[model samples]
Structure formats: structure tokens, C-alpha cells
Target: MSREFEFAQLLRAYRKGILSEKAFEEEMTRLEGGACGGFIAMGKTYASERDAIVAYLQRVRNGEAAGARALEQWAQVCKTDCMRSGLRTIAEREAYHVRVIDRKLNDLGARCEPAADPEIDRFVSMQSDPNISDLDKLRRITSSFANADEVVKPIYEFVDLIKQDLDAKEMLALWAEDEYSSIKWFLHACAALGGAAQSPADSRHEAMASAQTH
Candidate 1:
């Protein structure tokens, strides 16, 4: 059977509850044959790796743009000197990432579709609220992931699946490393604010500081 027909059958089975969500995802991953690189590209399936990359880049572009805006707004409201500096630095990096990703999407002959995310809107509002302490905002953001590395692990995994798209793979690999640095900073900032012991971010602080200077 064709991949399309097989995907349809799987979708029907999943919808009918014949397959659990995990099983359905595994089957979809198998059907894509690594076109999606075994990672759910924003929870959708694509027939080809290029298609998946195009869609994934669009999603990342959107998310990074939102993140940049949110962090900038948070920086404005943040009262702490160090937190404000770090927030602005991260915001700038996120904006730069979006620009590069947008260029890549254009090279692939695709335009980003404007997708509004309500969760992002709420997050921006929360982050920008002057009444919220910087520690609280740090807690809110860092709490989403179990650890710093968890945030960027999927990006590296996806990069590994790119068998032919060396350009995209290299780009994503660098992007993942950047995200790792940002998350490490966030975790360390949170810990310091909460009076917890010094975290692993201490070792990487010099690197993050170097990034800020750039």
C-alpha cells in the first residue's frame, strides 16, 4: 500500500481508539521512515524530510519570534539588574535565530504561515506583568522542563535524523547548542534567585557572558 493509504489507515485506527497515543505515534514515526527523523515535527507528519524541515522551521520561526517578544517585554519589567541583562541577551539571540530560520525557509521555497498561539499570548502577558517578581518568572519558565538539557534534547535528536540535508542538520545542531546555553542560564538564574546551591551553569557562565558581549 502507498504511504498515504497506510497513514490514513493508521489515523483511522488512532481516531477509533484502537491504538493508544503512543502506539499511534510509533506507527506514524515508522511510516515516515525517518522523513520526520522520528521526532514529531510540531505533532504533524510529512511525506518527505524536506517537507518536514520546512514545516519545522516555520514552527521554530514562529516560536522564536514569540519568545523574543516575550523576553524583551519581561526584561523591561524585570527589576533585577542581572536578570534584566540576561533576558535582553536571550531575547536578542532568539530574534537572530528567527531571522536565520526565516532565510532558510525562503531558500526552501516556503513561506511561514502565521499561526496564533493562545498559550504564547498568555505567557507574554505573565512575563511582562510588572507585579510579578523576576524570581517568579524564572520559576515559571524553568519549571516547564525537568532540566536545562531537556529543553534542547529534541533539537539534537532531530538533527541526527537528517541523513541528506547536511546544511539543515548543521544549522539545527548549532541552534540546539545555543538553546542549551540559554536554558542553562535560565536554570542557574532560577537557582540563584531561590537561594539554592550553585548549579552547573556556573561553569558555563563565562561562555554565556561571552555570548552576551557579542
Candidate 2:
């Protein structure tokens, strides 16, 4: 790939929370003064690493808000006792995290409006769709979000970036743990239902329909 293309990819990976701060910075230094096809000079949202991470928190909080509502919908209509209980528990956890992260955002003087997360939006849409059965929804989610460590690595990789806000750091750690717990619950619940994983057809449909490409 061209250097400029690779440089653009670096910026995108960081935005998608795929790059550690150290790696992101090193790559930025490496590409300094090199042609990056305007990735650096475009209308970037963040002025610094701190700003970008605060924005990340904002987006995630919005996700929790959406997730809490979406999960509750499933919990209400779910016929299976185990799945219902698991969905409710996860919904409650997400709701609590929403409050926690919202408070943290306000403490840091950040407003979480104008969230532009296509991934969360898509998840909520899929869950809310009437045609998609609840079990199928869970299957798709299990396939995409079963790995707790991988899901939250984006947030943990930037611990050094938020040292100024001890409160936010603490909240993040607690939230990450809860995320791991939630995924485990979903995984076990899926197994109990004998649908421990999404079928290849379902996976392909998810990839084709999912709004978040990265």
C-alpha cells in the first residue's frame, strides 16, 4: 500500500479504537511531513489525545444509553426464563453505566450530544426491528460482542491518556469489568439455548447489513 494510504489507515484505526496511544503516536511521528492524503489536516474532531478520548467516552456513554433501552425491549418479550433474566441484568448494568459515565462526562466538562456512532445506532436498530426474532438478535450479538477483552481493549489502551481525571479512570475500569461480565453472561446463555454461535449465513448477513465496517 502507498504510504499515504497507510497513514490514513492509521488515523482510522485510532478512531475505531484499534490502536494504542503509544502506537498511534509513533505512527503519527513516522508519517509526519509525509503525504497522508489530508487525513491529518482534515476536519478532525479532536484537538489532542485527551479531547479524542473524552469524545470516545461520550460516544460510549451514548451507546450505554441506547443499549439499556434496546436490551430492555428484548427482556420484556423474551420467552425463555434464562435469557430474560440475563437480558434484564445486562440492561440494568448498561443503564447504571450510562449514569456513571454521564456524570463523569459532566465532571470533565464534556457534553455527550451529537453522538455519531454508526455501530451503536445499527445495533439498536437491529434489536428494535420487529421482524428480527429476539433469539436471532442475541445470536448476532453473541457473534459480534462475545469477546470481552477484545471489546474493551480500545478503552483500556488509552489509560495513560486520561491520568488527569482519576474519577473517569476509575469509572472506566469498573465499566470495563462489567462489560466483561455481560459478555460472559451472553455467551453462557447462548450455549444453554444450544445456539452458542451464529451460523455462517447469519454471520454473512450481519457483515452485509452492519453499518460499522471497521
Candidate 3:
């Protein structure tokens, strides 16, 4: 690839969180001044881009698996028609993510390791409780994320980093968008129910609310 193209890719990777500030600077220096160096590892924990992508996929798979369970239970108990519908849709989506990630991990010749998460378990319990109001559950969900970007930033950053595994990259891109959509819907639902956050547009509310009757 041309040095200019490589430079643009490096810039994109840095912006996406694939490359650290230090690594980006180093690559920039190399490209700009024709300095000789090897490829620097991407993350603090992983040795290469594949390692980072695999690790990230593992983490996301675990979280999404747990979230799928919690959302399934929550949907069962959710009293609000609109919120319940959305919860079911999101639950299925999370479950699908787990399946796809698992397949990707298997294709990469990696073992699927189950990691224990106590906080996720607690959240599942709270979500499944029939006594808790839907609005309260919405608040609990939205409160965990400081903002919409907080929900999908890691996914997008990780997606931007992958160079060779186009399949995984594309899946992650869709996964990030799905996550973003779910969070936005939750935030809007929370706000529409008289929560403190700003409500989404009437059209969004209408679209989600329509799901209840279908």
C-alpha cells in the first residue's frame, strides 16, 4: 500500500481506538520522516491486532450472553407494553450476538471461556423481578450508561482496528450499531416515562410503541 494510504489508515485506526496515541505518533513519525521500525502492538494487554480483536470478542460475547438472559427475564416481567416489546427485541438481538461471536471465536480456533460476572447477575435478578416498575427498569438500564456513546464506543473502536478479519469487522460494525440503537431506544423510553433525561423524538416513540401491538 502507498505510504499516504497507510497514513490515512493509521489516522482512522487511531481515531477508532485501534491505535494508542503513542503508537499513532510513532507510526506518523515513521511515515513522515521515513524512519525504519516494525509494527507496534495495539493494546496494553494484547500483543497484536488479532489478539486484541479476539479478546474483545470474548468479552463482548460474555456480556451479551448475560444480557440476553437478563433481557429475556425482564421482558417476561415488564408491565409496560412498549418497553416490554423493545426488551424482547433487544433480548433476541443480544442472544444472536452471542451466537455470532461464538462462531467467530470458533473459526479463529479459540476456546470459549466463561467468565463470572457478579454485577451482571445482580442486574439480571433486578430486571426479572415482577415488582419493579418498567420505568424503574428503564432507569436502571439507562443509568448504567453515562451517555449513548458510552454504550458503543468500545465496539466501534475495536471494529476500526481490525484489518485482516473482514468478517469479524463487519459483524462488529453491525453489532455496534445494534447496541447503539438499543441504548437510544431505552434512553428515549426512559425519558418518555417521565424520567430526568431528555426524551427522543415523537417518531422514535411511535415506532417503538407500535411494536407492542404487533
Show model 3 residue runs off by greater than 4 Å: 1-45, 199-214
RMSD of each: 10.6, 13.2, 8.0
Cα misplacement distance, residue 58 of candidate 2 (Å):
1.4
Pick the winner on lDDT between candidates 1 and 2. Answer: 1
Best-performing candidate as measured by lDDT: 1
Residue 70 displacement in candidate 3 (angstroms): 0.8
Per-residue C-alpha lDDT of model 1 across residues 18-57, encoded as one tens digit per residue: 9999999998877766544543455666667788898779
Please report, as a residue range, the 10-residue window in candidate 1 with the lowest summed lDDT.
Answer: 204-213
115-163: candidate 2 lDDT, tens digit per residue: 6778777888787676776558868888876466888786676554453
lDDT of 3 by residue, 1-214 (tens): 4567888899999999999999999878866543343323334545445666677787778889888998999888887776777789999999999999899888878856888889888988998999988778888988878778887887777777666568888999999889998898788887767665454557666565555347
lDDT of each: 0.80, 0.69, 0.78
State the weakest 10-residue window (summed lDDT) of model 2. Answer: 33-42
- lDDT value, residue 152 of candidate 3: 85
Better of 1 and 3 by TM-score: 3
**Candidate 2 residue pairs in backbone clash:** none
lDDT at 56, model 3: 75
